[model samples]
Target: MGTTPQAGGTVAEPITLSTGETVSVPLSTEATVYGAIFSADRPAVDDLLPRGLEPIRATPRRAAVTVLAVEYHRIGDEVMTPYDEFSVMFPAVEAGERSWPFASLATHGASGYVWYLPVTTEPAKALGVDVWGYPKEVAEIDHDDHVAGRRTTVTADGQEVITLDVEAPPAVDQRQEGVSYTVKDGTLLREQLTLDGRLGAWPYSGQATWELGDHPRADRLRDLDLGERALARLRFDGEFVIGAGEPVGTV
Candidate 1:
């Protein structure tokens, strides 16, 4: 038998970048996550993956502030249906810090947004979009025709950046596997699911669009008939940081 090192004792090496700078990252698991980030689902430009760079221990110069969209696609013998799924997590930087104003919105069926300020001047408007949550799994009837995927498109002044990525499944066909972000111009999109071989192509999807209106956050959603059933059961836990820092790294 071979001896395996303890989990915490296993440290990942640092990676050198083209700009002569380096970053060190700590992986939540031993599995390689970079491969999923660079795969077809979340494609990256050439040199995007620095030489000897690995996600296990790679840290960006700045924290990432992104708007991610998780969409699920279900393929069936006769019908193709899509659902919106989401999960929000603060990175290591903002884990224990005070919650700031990050823009946020949630719709019942499709697209939504979380607008965060990262920093604020007024104390009264301290906690921006205090909580947010998304569905974990999109269900499937036969396990074969079901597929799920997500896409996170981020833009600043309508311009795109190249650092953020979607956490997608490595392979497009694996039943449990999902594709992470696919970067085009500046958007990161990912989808996961199993194809029953019924359709020749992917079906149209939906997004949960959320924004502030005349009423409060709760009332705003109600006006649109979004998620009137289980509003209380929704679990949205995350915080925003407002300061001088970069949201995501640049290539």
Candidate 2:
């Protein structure tokens, strides 16, 4: 059994799932990702967060929303059939914390609240929810590569949810560390994340487009008043590590 390290200078024991499967701590994966950050109405974003959390404003009156799709190729040291995922996230900080806006992203000072997560496999959904309280549902996620870039589509319950198209560009090596927040059983949880990869980004020059569908799940996002175009688009290819979640406070 591999021992995993926690953020608070302790080692985490493997978790035994309800399905009788054991998951090691500090989950690691190799994946290809495409993501974007969009501007949204601050008040609307605030309404979506749980208590004790506030939106990190990208601009006065405008918060930020992140949408990303990932294709996981391996887990731990084992290579497995790939699984796809699509996620919607809100950049936020704890209530009463100073908001640094754009600087927060560069410095990893803000926590990401996952609003929605759809995955292609049952294990992915189960592990996400059971381990970290990630709000995950099994869905159909399709990825296609074209000359211009890549297109990802998410469908759930026979209805389309969202589609994202991103252009490929030159990437530079980068490493990032951040925290993510989730709520489970009335408790707020925090997980540490680390990523090393080649990252490509483009400012809002029409390099990407995100479209929401008529699905009810999509309506939840529509309420945010997401901008017509993303503030920036990103692509990353490399490895990611997720630490065990620790409860921070009651929700």
Candidate 3:
């Protein structure tokens, strides 16, 4: 594990590989819980925006294709705002490759959502999306104060997939919580995640695997050069807060 990054800046920390080799590098901006989606060959219908693309404005234009939301913590650059939102796009008809999603620790006051809309409603389901909730300063925990539930699907055509559901306790308990991960085939392949604690315990211990048949959006994603990159070889650890999402007491 490495020291946290400074706000709006970078952090160089030592990381250990599975083989126990430790090296230090500037933690990637994408490595945090909050940040933008950086993709290759993103499509731009406007054709006039720089790089053949346009900055995502406040309009609901039909151009977005991926979104991720997470919390970030640090003390750095004064010019930029801390990561509270994230979005990414794919070039029209083009695919993405070797991309990483965002991650990070929640701030005392943080909350928002991320979204990715391909804009076209064809059979291609050529859309990408991610979202994050606000962050709040909360206590930590040890062990599993959270119970895990899962939703598995084997589509009519035999496409198998599973989604995990984790329920956080009413009150947090620090000391017994650690970040846990669900890997595929005992290898580092990005699957699903359920975490305990604030913004520090993630990518915990453990692994889970799965296989999928050809998907409907496969071609489009391939054209865009997205999907199936493999969670293999990718690893991270930290926990984040689900700030502002906790419910009020019952009447």
TM-scores for candidates 1 onward, in order: 0.18, 0.91, 0.22
Over the full model, what C-alpha lDDT does candidate 2 score relative to the true structure? Answer: 0.81
| Full-model lDDT, candidate 1 | 0.20
Best by TM-score: 2
Ranking by lDDT: 2, 3, 1
Candidate 2 C-alpha error for residue 72, in Å: 0.3
Model 2 clashing residue pairs (backbone): none
Off by over 4 Å in 3: 1-39, 44-157, 160-213, 227-233, 244-251
Clashes of 1: 46
Candidate 1's residue-wise lDDT over 1-251, tens digit each? 23223224444233333333322212111111110111011112111322221111111221111223323332111112233322222111111323221111111111111222211111111111111111121221111111332233322232332112222232332112111222222322222211121111111112222222232322422232322111111111111111111123221
TM-score of 2: 0.91
lDDT of 2 at 32: 91
Find the candidate with the highest lDDT and give its number. 2
Cα lDDT tens digits, model 2, 1-251, are: 77666434557568766655666767777889888888898898888899888888777778998888898887654523458999898888888888776766544422489889999977777778888899999999999989978899999999999999988767899987788999988888888887788877776647788888888998988888889877778888998878878887897
lDDT by residue (tens digit), candidate 3, 125-169:
211111111111111111112233111222222331211122221
Off by over 4 Å in 2: 1-12, 79-81, 105-111
